[model samples]
Target: MYGARLQRSTCTNCNAAYTRRYLKVQRRVTPAVALHSRARQRAARRGLPFDLDVSDVIVPSICPALGVPLVVGEMRSPYSPSLDCIRPALGYVRGNTRVISDQANHLKGVLDIEGLIKRAVASVDQRREDYARLAAYLDRELLLADVRRKAALAGAAGEEWAEVAKFLDAAFVRADWKR
Candidate 1:
C-alpha cells in the first residue's frame, strides 16, 4: 500500500498542522512594514509577484472546538491592541476569519460624548443665568442680608467678559443637540 500524499505539514509529536496563510491585523503599520507594503504595492503595479514581502504573527494554533490545529498566519505589526481585519487573506486558513466589531467601544465613545454635552449645556445655562444675574447684582446698592461680599469680579465682567458672554450665548443657542 502507498502512503497518502503530503497534503499539509503537521508536527508529528503534537499533530499540529499549519497551512500557508495569514490574517491581516487592522493595526497601525510600522515604518519597516509600511516600507515593505509600499514595495509590494509598487511591484504589483509593475505586474510582478504580489507576494513581495510576507510578515508573520503567532496566533491561535488550534481550534477551540476541535483542538485541531487551525491553519492561520500571524500578522506582523507595531501597534498594540490592534484588531483583526475582516478581509480574506492567506498565511494559513482553516476557516473564514470572524471579526466582531466591538460595539462596546462605540458605546463608550457615545457615553463620553453624552456626558460632555450634558456638562457643557449645564455650564452654558449657568453662564447665561450668571450673565443676567450680574446686571441685577450690580444694581443692588446696600447689599442684601444673608449674603457675604457679593462681588462681580470672579467671572462675567469687564469689556472682554461681556464680549465673551455675548459670543458664547449665541453659540450655545445654536449648538447642535442632535446626536
Candidate 2:
C-alpha cells in the first residue's frame, strides 16, 4: 500500500497531522500530455487589472446640437408712409398760422390760438379783478388773464412776433380812433 504513494495535506478541521498519513495520491509516469489540458494551458491569458476594449461597451455621443440661430433679412417694409400721418394733429397745440399772414386774401386762420387763448385768459382775469363782476356774473372764480395774455404774446413768432404785435395793435388803435 505504501509503494508509489505520496505525501499529501489532510483535512484542516479535523486537526489531523500527516505522519505516514492516511490519505494517499497515486503517481504515474505518462509519456505525453492530454490534448484538452494542453490546449487550455496555451489559451490567451490575461493578468490582474487587465485593460478591456470597453470603447464599444456602451458610451454616449459627444456631438453638439442640430443647428445655430442663422438670422435672415430683418428689414423695414419697402413702401413709405404718408405725409399726413407724419403731420401733427389739428386741435392739439392749436398750430394755426395766426398773427402772421397775407393781406389780399387774408388766408390766415383767425385762431391766433395763443392770442385767442390770451383773450380767453384775459376774460378770466377781468372776472377776478372785479369782485363785483364775479358776484354779478353769478358764482365762479375770475378767469386767468395772464394765461391768455401769455398765449396772445406767444402769437408773435419769435423775432417777427414783436413786429406783428405792433401791426395788430396799430389796426386796433385806428379802429378806436374812429370813435
Candidate 3:
C-alpha cells in the first residue's frame, strides 16, 4: 500500500468508501508545497524563470530580514512566511530565493539596493538634524544656567566674588568668547 499506487477498482461500494474516508481525514497542505505552487504560478504569470522544487523550499522559524517569528499558514498576516526573490529580475532561482516575513517582503517590494540605501540615508540624516536641534537647545539651557549662577553669586562676599570671576572667565574661555 505504501509503495504501490492505489488503482480504482470496478466496485462502486469500494470507491464510495474510499472517497468517504479520504474526505473525513482531510490532510493538511505542507508549507513547502504551498510556497512552491505560489512561486511557480507567479513566475508563470510574470513570465519569469522558475526552477524551484518543493524540496528546495524551506521555511525558517524566524524571518531573516525582520528577525520576527514567521507564522506559517497564517495568510495575510505581517509575520506570515513568504518566498522572496533576492533579485527579482533573476526570478525564482534556487540561489536567489529566501524565506522572509510577509511584511519584510512588502517593505522591499520593487525597490532595488540603491533605493533602499537612499531611504536609509535619508532616515539617518533626519535623525542627525533632530539631534543637532536638541544639542543647540541644551547648549542654550547651559548658558542660561551659568548666567543664573553668576547672578546668585553677585551678592556674595569679596572672596566668593573672586571665585565668580574665575568661573565666568572659564565659561568665556569654553565659549571661545574674546576678552
Candidate 4:
C-alpha cells in the first residue's frame, strides 16, 4: 500500500463545485538515494563519520571492482551496487566512498591493500608449488617407464641370442664339426 495515498482536491471554478480524489504518487528511491541512506545508517551504527548526501552517491552502470552490471533494489543480489568505504576508518566521507558490487565488497571484507596483496601472493605461491610437484611426479613416472622398456628389450635380445647359439651347436653336431 506504499505510495497509494489519496488526496482530495476541489475545483476552483465557480461552475464546478465537485471534490475529486487524486492519488499522490510517491517518489521512487533512486540508486543514489538508496546508497546514501544505507551508508549513512551503517556509519551511524558503527559510529563512523558520515558526510555523504544523495547527490554525492553516484552509482555507475557497471561496478568498478568486478566490471559487472550493477542492479538497484536487489538487496540480496551479488551484483547489487553497494557503497563501500575505501578506508573503513575514514568512514563514509566523500573521497573515501565508492560504488562497487556487493560481492566485491563482501569479498574484500575489511582487508587493506597490503593484506589483499599478501593473500594473493600466498595463493600464487601455493599454486606454483602444487604445479611443480605434479611436474616432478610425472617426470619420475616417465623415467621409470623408459627404464622398464629398455629392460624388456634387453631381456628379449638375451633370449634370442641363446636360441641362436643352440641352433648353431645343433648344426655343428649334425655336420660332425667341433668348435
The residue ranges of model 2 lying beyond 4 angstroms of the native Cα positions read 1-156, 176-179
Per-residue CA lDDT of candidate 3, range 21-99, in tens?
A: 5533331247767778889999999999999888877777766555567776544588877887766888997656667
Of the candidates numbered 1 and 3, which has the greater TM-score value?
3
Best by TM-score: 4
Each prediction's Cα lDDT score?
0.29, 0.23, 0.61, 0.56
Q: Which of the numbered candidates is closest to the native, going by highest lDDT?
A: 3
- Colliding residue pairs in candidate 1: 20-91, 21-90, 21-91, 21-92, 22-90, 22-91, 22-92, 57-74
Which residue pairs clash within candidate 3?
none
Of 2 and 3, the candidate ahead on lDDT is: 3
Minimum summed lDDT over a 10-residue window in model 3 is located at 170-179
lDDT of 4 by residue, 1-179 (tens): 33223331332542122211111111124667756876788989999999987877777766555456777754458888888776678788755666767876775667665555555556665443433332332233334334433444556775665565445433322332111
Runs of candidate 3 exceeding 4 Å displacement: 1-29, 123-179
Cα lDDT tens digits for candidate 1, 40-99: 565456554343333422223222111223332234322112112211132112111111
Global local distance difference test of model 3: 0.61
Error of 1 at 107 (Å): 20
Clashes of 4: 0
Per-residue lDDT, model 3, residue 150, is: 59
lDDT of 2 by residue, 117-166 (tens): 44445555432233222122111101122223344654354436555545
